[model samples]
Target: MDIDWPLLTGLIGLCGVGLLLAYSASGGDARALHSQGARILISLLLLGVASQVPAPWLHRLAAPAYLLTVLLLVLVEAIGAIGQGAQRWLELGPLRFQPSELAKLAVPMMVARYLSDRPLPPTLRDVAASAALALLPVVLIAAQPDLGTALLVTAAGMSVLFLAGLGWRLIGLFGALAAATAPLLWFYGMRDYQRQRVLTLFDPERDPLGSGYHIIQSKIAIGSGGFYGKGWLEGTQTRLHFLPESATDFVFAVFGEEFGLLGAIGLLLLYGFIIGRAMHIASQASDGYGRLLGGGLVCTFFVYVLVNIGMVSGILPVVGVPLPLVSYGGTSMVTLMLGFGMLMSIRGHRKLWPA
Candidate 1:
């Protein structure tokens, strides 16, 4: 099968940069660097395996995958492991995993499958059903109090709806409805800490040592890094432990602290190339399933980049969103690579099927 050379090249570059950033963030800790390296290797292997799987196989599995993930999310609520004050994972025997991560891919696939051949500008009923399909897991995940993952999953589902030709009038209507529900959601749905985050975005200094600490520190780290940065492993905020989650959620701040504005822009450009290539592949897909799935995945990937950067730069609330592959998270890296692999499968399968 033909390979997507540009996408692969962009991934390699990002992976390299991720390694460097992780190593520096860990303060020359070889163990952390090695662990990240191992995950990247595994992620690359999965990407290859996913790329090899035929689109027909993925299409057939879409519904089952979505159902299984929903079940797992329920299971998480029932018997999931708790970490960082949230019950978002299940531990069975020696294995522990986050079911919400599964929804990131499953929700999009199922949405695309449901909407693939549906009439364009779907009726109100169809839109509601699709929203239910997407938001069902979102509700379960929000119960996990993992608002970040829930938002990401919703974004992935919405990407499919948008690509499937959901009309602007309906989109505007939904937006208005969501806006109307914002207050109810804030008071009844969002956790106290989540609300604090929203509030903290406006004035992080209001609680500089409390709910706002993360944004405050993150901003300091980013701002402290001038044009070329403070140089690798020399970021005072990170090395001194002033920055929280330096290896994960705030890795961008660590990167910005060490590499400066130029490095940050370069990283954004790299992500831009990756997203562009994925969307291009999506456009070239041979079938509706392939096109919608590819496009949904690309759009979801874009959300990850946007939210993470926005949060770190203090323009948006901190929602525990990681900086895509660059952040030190195995689950996210693997999930992202799996999406890329599926994109490759969609692109490569097109020539043979030509449907």
Candidate 2:
């Protein structure tokens, strides 16, 4: 089998956890479990198909895929469905999906493709071009006010540049520039509620029933779990519906409240193993494009996990990043699984690529 079993096993384990938690969070709602299960199956199937695609094919498709995704994003801006106070999703007849999710893959693919043909440690011009490719969709997504996806897309593209051996001096310079623009983004780019989320992070009690409600409840649930947890389906916060978005963004809190500290450690270890295996695969790539794409995808996945856990634990401001493979969402699940499939493709097709 061309499949990387350890990575596959780790992914399956997380999906299983998701199903379990979803069942509990929905208060044993069979429809919710079935819906999530169907999406997982579809995503896994796509992963299988994506794993069989050759590297050259992936490289060949990068530009067109990216262009098409960008176009879709534009279409979204014009006619996208409004949901949850944001115009982020597009509905085409029977289908409804977020173009921002596709941007997560497309931006990195485009960046890796551009950088692979250039010299190692790209020149300023090359870096500028790659950043442009990245920022185009980022600007569009951010305009949709999907700040979380915008940040992830930015991370996705930037990870490719970093993997291409962008220098420490340039990294430092850009970091400073970003810091300098932070206040501008806060004042000009952020919406009112977005600003409130940041403020709520410091003192959730400031708006306990408003912007702070989500994180505050999340913290209480996680803290109540203690060492051994309250036990499966026995989570008081979840059972009583005190935790908001229990099946989606804040699902980790429900997990903590039920499974405790030990379960959380186990979950993190599983994530670590998957990340370690994927990085190893990336390291073994036969060509620069493979390395860049694989590494960038892995880094994006890492950020997804980090941000979700951090937000749930009340350590970071809630930016609405879902836990990879665990959060109950079709678009995020499909996007992540597709990236993993590409990682598997890099591993499977390495020897076939030209040196």
| Best model number under TM-score | 2
Across residues 118-233, which tens digit of lDDT does each residue of candidate 2 receive? 88889999999999999999999998888899989999999999999999999999999999999999999899988988998899998789888999899999999999999999
lDDT score of model 2? Answer: 0.93
RMSD, model 2, all Cα superposed? Answer: 0.9
Top lDDT model: 2
Q: After superposition, how far is residue 144 of candidate 1 from its true place, in Å?
A: 0.5
Q: Which lDDT tens digits does candidate 1 get at residues 1-355?
A: 5569899889988888889888888888998889999999999999999999988878888999999999999999999999989999899899889999999999999988888758765677877888999999999999988888989999999989888888899999999999999999989988788888999999999999999899899999999999999999999999899999998999999989899999999988999999988899999988888999999999999999999999999999888888899998699999999999999999888876536
lDDT (Cα, 0-100) at 176 in candidate 2: 100
- Backbone clashes in model 1, listed as residue pairs: none
Q: List the residue pairs that clash in candidate 2.
A: none
Q: In candidate 2, which residue ranges exceed 4 Å CA deviation?
A: none
Worst 10 contiguous positions by lDDT, candidate 2? 53-62
lDDT of each: 0.90, 0.93
The local lDDT score (0 to 100) that residue 17 gets in candidate 1 is 82
* Span of ten consecutive residues with least summed lDDT in model 1: 116-125
